[model samples]
Target: MGIDTFKEKCGYEIDEMWLPRVTAITSILNKPNLYRYFADSPNYPAAQRRLDSAAEWGTLTHEVVERMLKGEIVKPDAKIIPSIKAFQKWRENNIMRISDPEKDVERLVVDTKHMFAGTLDVVAEVNGTRGVIDLKTSTGIWEEHYLQTAAYLSAYNKTARLKEKCTTRWILRIDQYEECLGCKAKRRGKEGVLRVTGGKRICNHQWSEKKGVVEFKELEGYKEDIKAFLAAKELWEWYNKKFIRRIPNYAKN
Candidate 1:
């Protein structure tokens, strides 16, 4: 997308200067799994529609999760209650303490040095260690998540006080799925399609009730991850050079 589109879709402008969004930059990376998904789908339009629907669902979950983090009383949409319940269960079992939900939730971070920006989900102290906590509603955590969170952690720490600097990052994935009783297979009905994995194919599977699942993983080697993110940013810049060059406020370097 062009600069105008970034302003509308991503809102990454700082002081009238357009900077590429972290997610937009990361989108430049080749995703083999996504390619396989498209290859396995019926057609391009059908695959894209599923992806779009998944994005909408993710957005809803993000909004609701942010509200819950802020301690706001929320009546979650019926579509996402299972996921929300899973998140709540995780919250109850963990020691993640958001010091100030108002400032910590959905906080926007900018990397002036790198000329990119993104909104981080949460900055909190988990089990006495402070870090960035990114929320996801995907079926599984992928390698690209490391690059995205590394970018957020670097950008956030650049301007944060020493006490507030995040030393690590975590991906908090909340999802709801069913399990096949006979075959021990997991089935997900998100993304506008049903996907089954890890079970005997020929078995007449008795599916379990829909339940939430939460996975929390701490990312390591962020120093290298940030380097990778910058490289991705450079490649993204090259891809959008024509549009980027027209934006007067964007840093030229």
Candidate 2:
């Protein structure tokens, strides 16, 4: 997870692409706080806990989806069962075929040209259109997601040579209402449900849109997006001193 590991695996030291994590760059740049559902609450700790819980659930969702896509049996907990089922239903309904569900599916890639590294979620084709797709449990897709995807695509293109390189890109978002924090937040306002249990507020929530899949083609100007993402990478490096050379005293004359 550190630069040393990257160096050992990538067979290189920190050059142009030291270890500038792609997600970190997009997050540091102008990424919006999509988890601002409880910003207005006086109980900041509870709000933070809520955010933490959602993040943990998101990770679980990713695991479930990954297992299912790889043709592995999944036995998710009771809480995340609904979201898992929803994703299963979507994949079944959409007739998704596992394009490349290999162990290297989610790979940590270093784009030496661009000076960034990140693990891409999925590289596969859905419904016969080949592309790089990222799974999301978030409420909605954001510009930052595209920026992140652009970085992944850049790395994929540079490292791996495929018979037919993926020119199509997509953000496949699968989520259920009960697992969504924002949806639960709305229940307190719209439904006036103040029901509390086991030191937690339980409200009647329902899914608005169970599943959403967006196809982002290279024709959508991914070349331009890559340029912008690299610019942000430079900004992040300069600000964080990632590109600075300290000149170790032992090496220095």
- Best model number under lDDT: 1
- Candidate 1: which stretches are off by over 4 Å? 1-3, 6-11
Clashes of 2: 1
Q: What's the TM for model 1?
A: 0.94
**Collision pairs in model 2:** 17-115
Model 2 bad stretches (over 4 Å): 1-17, 34-38, 178-219, 242-253
Put down candidate 2 lDDT per residue, 189-241, tens digits, no spaces: 11112212122255454433332333333336697888888888767656645
In the order shown, the candidates' Cα RMSDs to the true structure are: 1.6, 7.2
TM-score for each candidate, following the candidate numbering? 0.94, 0.72
Error of 2 at 245 (Å): 4.2
Model 2 alpha-carbon miss at residue 78, Å = 1.3
Count the clashes in each prediction. 0, 1
| Per-residue lDDT of model 1, residues 1-253, tens digit only | 6657755663366888877788988988888778756875899998888788888899999999999899999999897899999899898898989988999999999886877889999999998899999999988789899999999998899889888998899999998889998989998777788888889989998999998889999999998999999998888888877877777777544
